[model samples]
Target: LAKTKPIKRFNSPLRKAAALFKELHANNGSKIIARSTTQDRMTKSAEYFLAGFFGLEWPTNVTLLLAIEDSTGVWNNSLAGYYNCNNSNNYRSAGGNNATIEWYETYLADATARLQKLAPGFGWTPKDSYDAQSLCAYETVAYGYSQFCGLFTYEEWQGYEYSIDIQFAGNNAFQSPTGRAVGIGYVQEVLARLQHHTIDSPIAQINVTLDNNTATFPLDQSLNFDFSHDTNIMSILTAFGFTQFAQFLPSDRIVPHELVVSHLEPFAARLDIEIINAPAPVKASRNNTDLYEEGKATKYIHFILNQRTIPLHRSFPDCEERDDGWCELDIFLAVQSKSFEISQYDWACNGDYEAVPYGEVTNGVPTQTSS
Candidate 1:
């Protein structure tokens, strides 16, 4: 679950999520799978949610799985794929793709130029701008409000928010050809879990197991929770081909106001995929001579982003459209399986990329060209 910081104001959403989880799986004997990044804030977020679930003060009995290592260039954890493949052309030194940095420079030029006069002796580079923006969010969440929040005018904060939007778009979405590639490993693992099967990718080498027998990797669990940085979430969304967020920059002068990161990966942004069983729709055979009914009921999958239901604009084959973003379970699995089959993890991440962009190869097919 994407959540805000562990502050009191953010407690309601976590409580609501806990209540929903309990309501759905309380008696099913399904285990709660909790995983998070190594960062303290993320760990604390998980702890707060667990407290809400068990109604305990500390909830120390609840085991929180720490998945990512706090090291550089570590590919062991798929959840930290962007950091693992840090040198990929998909990112800039300040972070994000070349275009993202360009946008940051263009949009923040006025604000940054005035920073020395406004804040006095405050020199701002692209990285400084990024860090200041991050500080604003961090301090606000930690203390209910932040002193740094007052340093910038409302217009400057808007520019800072845009800076983050471009960064996410260029490095974690389809706008950059390599964006989806960084997410393929996690996608493979998700597909494996859905099938109750083991993943064969290099991500399996990290000691994270999905054998259906391990307590941490039980296949029968109805709810699986993973906590990580916003980069991973954005990457997964891109890998799944959610084109609604695939925003491209037409020119350096234009700012994508619609593509805001505060809404996408705010303090507590949660993306929930729900699997539900509903009556199957009856359909006539291709010949129109006979009726076809496979069973009384079928499973459908729907997505919830930040408590809002987002309809699928594109999905697997044979998936019937619904206003509530529901797709056939079988079709969803098939689509994910196809993605797994096409994803050559090792080759894409480590092999020769002289002819193609990193993370663009799927089953030997190139989804994008080298630029």
Candidate 2:
């Protein structure tokens, strides 16, 4: 009998991602600025990621900034901004879970009865059916197999995906009152980094103490990595005025929209904002390869979310059309410069205001409260 080849361990997602970045900028971990929340999972993710990006001995190469994730304290942490913003923890943020509940009640009604009949004496509600569906996804991820996975039809799976979409739409995306407020800090930090300056003033959930210090928040680094929660990522997208996801989602039925939470913020989801420099203006050819256009060398900004290119032109009118889905850096900066004002962080998070109905506040702020 022939001997079988030894099985090799698969590369972790964090390591694979780090390896990709290493290819572009090798042995330059010292130049990178990385931060994560103080939570064990987040900090550990940072450790594993740094180890892959730098080396097994990554500690000597780079310093990982740990931000506090407390809600009651005055310390602001962009990675865990939801904890800092009171409104984010209030009923406002519950919109997502509320939306999911509404959706599951409608879609899982039939499934609940059908599954209950199969088990005879076991009573099952829509919540139980939804929990089972969730178990299918979680078990598949954890154990690589799940008996619950095959119980649902393709349409039911689509419904499940929509349920997730509605939850994010109402809770963290455009529909949430504190959506922009929760993510404005991270956006501010990114803008400060791009403009090569420290954040002089405290705004929203920005950690002023660290941001004011050059050592903790250096603006000179070309590469900045921040690890954060999935909900916060969605909030950041809304804060950046990605209006493509600003559409109103109905709880009763699936609607045609760009806001798909499963696709946008799946496990280990990543968003990369790249500053590309081309010798000349570039355009994508018929085959999607970049080709030089007639213009002087210029800097452009590209946004990639979960391996998909997000077209800046769709959100910002100032961003010129390009087949490559890139916006001129100057144009992009100008568009984002107004994000602080648009976010209305102070008013949205702390102002005395009544919450609007779910679909009424579709742009991340209450229209009646926002000035």
Give the number of the best model, judged by lDDT. 2
List candidate 2 stretches off by more than 4 Å. 1-31, 120-122, 283-290, 293-295
Q: Output the lDDT of residue 79, model 1.
A: 66
lDDT tens readout by residue for model 1, 1-371: 22111112225878866665555555255345667767788888777777775667433334577775555664356666666644234322123445455666666666566665666666667656656666988887778887667766777676666766766765566544445656766676666666677643345223345323356654556566776668777777776666667655332554544556788788778888776654543342234533335676666667787777756644333566554566766877776665544433444444444433322322222343334
Give candidate 1 regions above 4 Å deviation: 1-23, 27-31, 57-62, 68-75, 83-97, 118-134, 147-153, 200-213, 255-258, 282-295, 315-318, 341-344, 352-371
Task: Score every model by TM-score.
Answer: 0.74, 0.88
Q: What are the lDDT scores of the predictions, listed in order?
A: 0.58, 0.81
Write the residue-wise lDDT of candidate 2 on 180-208 in tens digits. Answer: 88888888888887777898787888888
Q: Give the top-scoring candidate (TM-score).
A: 2
Clashing pairs in 1: 3-268, 4-267, 4-268, 342-363
Model 1 — which ten-residue stretch has the worst lDDT? 1-10
